[model samples]
Target chain A: MARLREGLRVQLNVIQALTSRELMTRFGRENIGFLWIMVEPLLFAALVGIAWSFIRGPVNDEINVFAFVVTGYIPLTFLRHSFGRSAKIFVANSALLYHRQVKVLDFIFVRVLIESVGAMMAYMFAGIVLAFFGLFPFPADIGVLVLGWAIYIFFVLSLCTILAPVSEVSDVVEKLVPVSIYVSIPFSGVFNMASWLSPELREILMWSPLVSGMELMRYGLFGSAVTPYYDLGKAFGVSIVCLLIGLILCRRIRRTMTVT
Target chain B: MIETRNLHMDYRSGHVTKHVLKGVDFTIKPRDRIGLLGRNGAGKSTLIRLIGGVEMPTKGKVIRRMTCSWPLGFSGGFQGSLTGYDNARFISRIYDKNYSEMKEFVEEFTELGSNLKMPVKIYSSGMRARLAFALSLAIEFECYLIDEVIMVGDKSFQDKCKEEFFEKRPDRALLLASHSLETVQQYCNRAIVLKDGRATTYEDVSEAVAVYKKL
Candidate 1:
């Protein structure tokens, strides 16, 4: 018990150190600084919301366009931002690993954490702001929304852990990430709703853990305005599988790392 | 003491692989001042890194009961955008030391002056070395690993380094890896000569230096 407590203390200290370093290097003390994380997502969501409102018009009177877009786009943005940093995390922080207390897990987890909080703040603040303009309604079930967001974060983080180490060994993974990020926009469960599709199409999309999480989040917001198709069992199962695989992969990365 | 057994490190680039350390076994006892001698690619640095736990060995174990400092004067640990003081604070956080105390030591040791407030990328190489030296020393350790740290800066700076490290820490253990045989002979009581992916220990520093010169 004493050993576990000491280990936790060291881990917490290392986490704080790495987290501050990451934040300082990324945002610096310029105009707005770290506020960029929250603001950037809002901008992305708002821009897409406006575009969709212009192109498709109002699909249903019960649903707000901005709320629909915010729910999807902000979550997608979180994944993009998190995975984007995960790719070259080793190269950037490898020097700090010289400190025996600093581990590969610290770097991977800290980046995900910063991005996760940023997305959460952006999602909450966006809803309030959009509601003021009558563009979005307050979530009917904040509890469910939070739960869905947490699960999505878990799923994305597991993927990030895999990407962080995989990108180190494979040039193909590096090339694939950027292309996949762009390609995933439509299928990201952002602009598209699972309930809007045919049974076969919805079943195919439901195969994606991201889509499942997205539908859950959408249902939490839209309530009776739209139907949400998701299986919590499936989302949790796939995420656990990915998390285990990612951890196993990250553990093996030490063997492949350059000695000096 | 920090002990290692059958340590091996291999570097892979493209289709080729070069073995750096093979079955190298050694222990860093408390207060042991050891000089590491080897050729340019002799894995002197690699051995230090493995011992320091920066990188894991391919087929061995490193059991460090004693805390070890990072390769002294390694400037790579600093984030380019952060000021010298910020980096120091970050280090203090990682080591669970007091930030104010680390800053105080850094200000006195680095002599970076106002440069401590500026981004590290703008500083000269000498300034960085000084900052690295200050930060490393601020965090006390059982063992200090030096990898040709004296090669940087001018002669006076080198003298200051020798004084701060060799003179100040008389009882602290040190593993100094350098090409300068004079420095090694003067400070280290023992030596480890690395060659062909293996280590040979010498009780007499002069003997290891003699063997190192022939290699």
Candidate 2:
């Protein structure tokens, strides 16, 4: 518990540095500095929606294709970027790590918070723009939607912390990032609801916490029926386990990993 | 009250382990100023690092009954992109202290003037050395581990350093590691000369200088 308290304090300091640097370096010395945070990600979502228009039919049948893509793209963007950067954090901020008060977990937590917050803000902006154009109705349940996003963010943060060190040592894991994205693209549970999966298939897929998180999110926000295997118990279990494993991995490699 | 018992450090590079500190022991008491003198690669810097908790020993323990500052130098610690003022804030936060007082002191002492607001990477070596020295002195550690920091700066700042270090912080114990004979003799009472990773204690400052000179 004492360690936890200390970790929280260190995390606060890390966040201060991370946010200051991110805001300063990214926005630069321009007048429309802060506005770019929302604009950039929404632009990417727009581009993807446009590209998908030509590749196939609609991106989703249940909702406006753009809205569906925006919903899925926002969280995943945060997940991917956080994981990618967090993996190399120890190397990137060696100076900060050498200080006694700065911990390995603090660095990872700061990166996760910054990326997740930025992505969420961008998603909110996109939602407002789409609403103005009458592209989709306001979300059915704002509370559930927010909760689902929070849970998904938590799971991804834990997973990235665990995978970061492993990815650093092996170029194989780095190369596999996009490949994993491509493979998981079909199973993202965005286009197809988990309710449609066969009982056996649902049971097997629930083993993947990412899929479980997405399925649970869909149910919470859209009142979509989840497969019989959609267990909040399982999602919570996997999240807890992954977080513990990640913490252990972080502790062991804290000293060995070179700060960049 | 600081001591290391049977401390051993091995710097491993792929296939070989080069022992920097091969089973050494030493003790430092309150207000006891000690100078560590040795030739290049004699593990002088390594010893200071181990004592400061920057690096852990492969075997044995560093019993620190008080806080110890890391070796004073403009090295791989400060963020190059941050201004000296911002860096000072970070250093204070990490040390769990107030930055306002130290920031003012460092600003006045470093004499970098407008350069304090500029990124640290843009500062000259002498300016960096001054900043490093000022940062170390700003943090009120129970024991300071000085490494090759006293040799820098003009005669006036050097005198300022001595007055502040000796007169103001007389109660603070110091472990100064340097090759400069004058610094070792003037700043420290007891001296430890490291040779091939082994530390030998000298009763008089002059005796340690003789050993250091021969090396």
Candidate 3:
């Protein structure tokens, strides 16, 4: 018990160091610095929301287009950014492995935390701005929204964990990840509602952990105006499976692989 | 104490497999200053890296009971965009050392002055090496694994490094890999000659240096 506590303390220290290093390296010392973390995603979501407002007319009669876009794009941004960068993290931060305290999992954890926090702040910031203009309403189920976001974060983290080690072992997987993410967007349910699809298609889509998360999030955000379809059991099961696989793969790679 | 048992490392590049360390066994105890000597591809650095826990061997295990520092003088650890101060703080935090003390030590040792506030990418290779060396010393590890001779800056800087590693920290263990027999003779009391993925330790530094010269 004492040893476990010590180990946790060491890991926490390492995680703090890694997160700070990541922040400094990414944002630099210049104007605004780490604030860019919040700004970059905000700008991306805002631009997409404005463009969709003009093009798509209204995503739903009761739901505001800006709110829908913010909800969809912000979470997708978190997932995409985290997963997109996961493959390259080992190679990019391989130098840090020199310190025995620093582990591969620490890198993934830091990245996930950064992306999640950034996305959450961006979502809230956009929601506030839209509410000020009377274009968006306060979420109907904040508790459910928070829970859904937590599940989505869990799924993203597990996916990233699986991808990080796989990418280290195979160059092909690294090359294909970005393209795969782009291709997987429609299936991710970021732009479309699950209720819009036929029962058969919706059943198939809900099996995807990301789609389930999106549906659950929209359910929490939009409430009774739209029916959200998701299987919480399936989503949780998928996330756990991915997490276990990722942990095993990462351990095997760390044990057998040499950092060049 | 740190020990490697029958350690074997092999690098696979496509169809080719290059054996780096084969059945190399050694132990590093407290206050033992050992020199590792080998040819260009004799796996001296590889042996140091394995001992440091930065890389895993293909066949055997590295048993580290005490904390060991990474291969010093390797400048790849620093993030290019972060200022020198940020790197120092990061290292301190990771090692659970006092950040202010580390920063002060690095600033004083490297004599980087205003340049310490600038991004490390802007510094010269020599400046980077100085910062790396200073940070390594600040951590105060039980055993230091040095890749080669950590030559940095001018004559005064070299003297300072020698003083810090040798004069001040005489009791600290060192496992240094270098081709220069003179450097090994100066700093190391014992030596190990690595050839064809094997290690032969000599109690007398001159004897190992002589064996290395013959190889």
Ranking by DockQ: 3, 1, 2
Report, for every candidate in turn, its global Cα lDDT versus the true structure.
0.83, 0.75, 0.84
Ranked candidates, highest lDDT first: 3, 1, 2
Q: What tens-digit string does per-residue lDDT give for candidate 1 at A155-255?
A: 98999889999999887888788789888776658887887888988777765778877877887887777788887887888889998998998889965
lDDT of 3 by residue, B120-174 (tens): 8898878887888888899888898887646435777778978998899987899
Inter-residue clash pairs, candidate 3 = none
Please give the C-alpha DockQ score of model 3.
Answer: 0.65
Looking at model 2 chain B, report the run of 10 residues with the lowest lDDT sum.
B69-78
State the lDDT of candidate 3 residue by residue for A1-260, as single tens digits: 99999999999999988887777666655647546655665576678778887886666689877677678888888888898889868778887888887899999999999989888987887778779987678788988788889888999999888999999889999889878888988888888888888999988887788888888778788888778888888899999999999999988888766665
| iRMS of each prediction | 2.0, 3.1, 1.6
Q: Which candidate leads the pack in DockQ?
A: 3
Candidate 2: tens digits of C-alpha lDDT, residues A1-260: 99899877866766676566545545645747557757766787678777878788674555666766676777777777776776566767766655656666766777787777888788788889977886545666676666667767888788877877666566687777767766775555645556677778777667666666666555554454233235666677888899999888877766445332
Docking class for model 2 is acceptable
lDDT, model 1, position A32: 74
lDDT of 2 by residue, B1-215 (tens): 99999988887667997988888888999899999999989988888877876666788899999877766664656778888887887777666667899888898888888899899888876777788878878887888887786776778779888887899889989998887888889989999999887899897999989978888
Off by over 4 Å in 1: A33-36, A40-47, B73-75, B153-156
Candidate 2 regions exceeding 4 Å error are A1-37, A51-62, A167-192, A196-198, A224-229, A257-260
CAPRI quality band, candidate 3: medium
- Residue B146, candidate 2: C-alpha displacement in angstroms: 1.8
